[model samples]
Target: MGDLAAVVAARGVPAQEVMDEYARTLDRLVDPVRHPSLCWLRESGRLGTPDEPDHDFRFGLERVLDGVEALARGASA
Candidate 1:
């Protein structure tokens, strides 16, 4: 995976631009295979709305912490 800003290893490319590039790459990778079914909730971006109470929170925090722990343990070994 490529990190934002300063390149993976140069020139003066901004971090946000690199991130946007990555997001577009991810979007291309997961292109929709078929159109929405007859019974589907139609919306933009994602299923949950950002304005909703539960929409924004620590959903990915635990997963990220676990990944860091795994990397730490691997380094120790």
Candidate 2:
């Protein structure tokens, strides 16, 4: 996730309060009727916060490694 790293590097870490304010703004802006999918995402609480900078990167890397390991196991078998 080079893009994620780049964004984090460029912006640095944002304050939790600032992020919370942005989340609130998003809540207000996303109309349930007009953007049902976005509304669902907003309500789902899956929109991760910026508390941990490397969380998403680490998660993606772990999933990729898991897939590679599975493929290796299949090939050996």
Alpha-carbon lDDT, every model: 0.48, 0.72
Check candidate 1 and list the clashing pairs: none
lDDT at position 54, candidate 1:
33
Per-residue alpha-carbon lDDT of model 2 for 25-75, expressed as tens digits? 888888889999987876776563554667777898999999999999999
Deviating ranges (above 4 Å) for candidate 1: 5-9, 31-77
* Clash number for candidate 2: 0
lDDT (10s digit) by residue, model 1, range 1-77: 22332362265665555545655665555535553531133224333222223323345677788899999999999
| Candidate number with greatest lDDT | 2
* Stretches of candidate 2 exceeding 4 Å from the true structure: 1-40
Q: TM-score each candidate.
A: 0.33, 0.46
RMSD of 1: 11.0
